[model samples]
Target: MSAPENREAFVRPPALELRGVTKRFGAGASAGRGARALDGVDLVLGEREFLVVLGPTGAGKTTLLRTIAGLETPDAGSVALHGRDARALAPADRDVALVFQNFSLYPSATVRENLAFPLAAPARRLSRAEIDERVAWAAKLLHVERLLDRPAKKLSGGEMQRVAIGRAIVRRPKLFLMDEPLTNLDAKLREELRVELRELARELETPVVWVTHDQAEALTMADRVALLVDGRIVQTGTPEDVYARPNSPLAARELGTPPMNLFDVERKDERWITADGVELARADAGAPERATIGVRPEHVLLDGGPSDAVVHVVEDWGPSRVLFAHVGAHALHVLAPRDCALRAGDRFRPTFDVRRVVVWPRA
Candidate 1:
């Protein structure tokens, strides 16, 4: 085959695309004046891709999802699905499933009824047998079949969430928009559901846009992560790529656990030194004279060097210990093995993993 033929063969359109999408809310004193919830956001979702929209609270993650689901109108730009413009499409016509953070179900209704409600829509035109089959399939897939006969209000929080998810999956929509569906669950349950939902999406071969402020969910579940801040998409890349090479300091902060350690520094003697002449790390060959260097907690090592760090606190995180300490006048967080016996007030030396440092121009 020729190059052109190869290219044409794999040129299928993306599952979803947003071009300069912007949305605003709350008209102030002026009729058209309002706060920007989304500012010229652009993104693309490949067929069967799981893209996580990672951001902080009030960063417009929910607004983005709502706009995509047709529940909110964008003030500008276009939304497209599978190469077709969705401007004229209503919420139901879009054939997209949106699962919210709160478990949405009729408390008085049985789990089976809740799961079957979506199928009962007149537009679906699904036969009774087909509806039953779909509900059964979704319940089995989500492992909520045992609770099918119980009322939604009688189920545990985890169970109700499962049924709510079942309601969405029963439709088998072309796209899935999940808005932090597991945020309300307990930690262990959230972890369990995260893996389950990821596998389910893969098995169904569905494209999903999952929104979350939690970096753990984004890093563990996303095929790609879009870092949103201040109503704009700062960067988008695979989880590994974003974590390893964040385009900016904000992107670095969006995907880390305790977040990256960022501080302004000056370049001198081929190194980045802090304000007090404490060398932070080796300078990149093309690093600017003044820039910010970001070091991950794990990259800050307690090497017993001459850095003079006083431990402010030690947090045991099961697999590792996090040491919050002050090195000189700058406070830092360091990661150590769980077996380390460092206590508060203990003095130690901290070293930066120079090879892993990330630098950005000073802002």
Candidate 2:
């Protein structure tokens, strides 16, 4: 197929779509207190799109994933896969593959057996030769072919994860759902597998909805990320869009390494009059009258310009230095290159990167 036709052929509508999905737990007396796992959540995943869902524990990340995987039913909503109503189909019939956080492989099973299990489904009805072929293919794809004869119980966490991923891929499903598949691996292995997983997803040309609480994983792997909070999708966008232009304070807090420094400050005309009497020029003069002042640590400089402040603490974190300064009652952090010399108890004027400062309407 030509590039355009290949793209058209791959356009299989949305691999998954959720419309007004809501899930609530409990009853009247308990209902007033029950958790609302998902609230009117709506999302769409294009064919071959890799989307990650991020949220803290108890944020309903699992619930949302389960709903899509047919493990949990929403109280109110519709789930469609390839324009077909998904609620009508069972998990196996939906042509979806899910890899759980825990390597849920049978202890006695060898890697080959584990990879063959999904293909052995009655719906698949593949010949023994076909199953063996797919299992070998998947193991090769995940670089686990050498370990195909090893029992699941004897495999290392990373090796077992690869086997689990291999099993998922061997099914050749329309969509792949992963719930923190790399959470158990060591940092180095996790990083290695993350790259491999991305390549695998691309090579398979299947839509992937991966659930992860790790911001770095979500940012690095996803074509788009859906930030879930208390079961609601607070925001969804490309990593850069979500990080650079957070729609709310909650959304802003979810993305950054140290997170953006938010301070309740008074907005006077086109300037920010911090509680400590420091004045910050606003790049956007038409910002809300009373708003929160947000500036990332990297945007605050210790020297070479205007405002003055008393340093409270300086923390050395190898590659960079974080300076905690008191501007008044509010404490602000300034991230500086490690070579910059500044100490605690020192009073110095700091410069703000006006272009990077963000103003949000007071919450």
Candidate 3:
């Protein structure tokens, strides 16, 4: 390669990179006796990227953030920050900001002081004017400028969260780490902040590694998502890609709302049959005799079909209906239009969108 090309290639690196990172708790981390919080996880985040680590509770989402922030040390593998090994950097030296679900702030101080606290760190050399300017900028960006003079104790939950996030942004760190920061807010506030935070991250052009168990946040805000399960990195892809083309049943279960309905079935000739000998759908000629298949709620069409289904319950969503039903022996969820006149004890023939069905080897 030419010298200029070499130089260009050398200059650009991922904002954050993790390779075979492993962390454990309890006894000595290296003894292999402790519970592993992170295990052989690999991920890469591009410059100014928004990556959400989506997982269930106890999936080591919090541990992943702490390891990135230098608050926790991994027992194995490497963490690279902007191409440099992070083994030697202290938490403060890594130039990263962390925001948590619980609003961590100085309750007695005004919002201005809370936002400015990070800049006042002993390690930072910012002058008073610089700190104040950044505080104003962060507060304005978070739409909490009006609450600057209010005591932290006086702010509502949403305001306090904005301030917590403002405190992180005021320092202008290279990366932002958020651990379910909106989980504590009411539904309306959480919805509002999700959009706001996404815009803020783009406006700042700062890379973020936000972790959450909420699939909604991952789907709505992420440029890409990393599925973490049992301390392992299961899958990484754009929200749409991961949602539509999950690599495994475990991966399929992580993203969907009302979750994907999975079934274990046996392939019989050209058909897939459920446990009780009821035909479910068509099976690929080359497919395994027994495997697991997944169908999302919306894919279960109820207009008219071959199989009989009895609606056990109906939930009226604002614009649609969710029917909990039994199709033969399979308990299923079907999404129907709000106008559909279906109630409990109603019966319909349910057909599935076979093209969208996902199949995996039975485990």
Off by over 4 Å in 1: 1-9, 29-32, 304-306
What's each prediction's TM-score? 0.93, 0.92, 0.94
Ranking by lDDT: 3, 1, 2
* Model 2, runs deviating above 4 Å: 1-12, 26-33, 275-277, 304-307
Measured by TM-score, how close is model 2 to the native structure? 0.92
Best lDDT among the predictions, by candidate number: 3
Clashing pairs in 2: 27-31
Error of 2 at 71 (Å): 0.3
Candidate 2: give its CA RMSD in angstroms. Answer: 2.8
lDDT of 1: 0.89
Q: Please estimate how well model 2 matches the true structure, expressed as its whole-model Cα lDDT.
A: 0.84
Which pairs of residues clash in candidate 1, taking residues 3 or more apart in a chain or in different chains? none
Model 1: lDDT of residue 137: 93
CA lDDT scores, all candidates in order: 0.89, 0.84, 0.91
lDDT of 3: 0.91
Question: Where is model 3 more than 4 Å wrong at Cα?
Answer: 1-11, 27-30
lDDT by residue (tens digit), candidate 3, 164-204: 99999999899999999998889999999999999999999
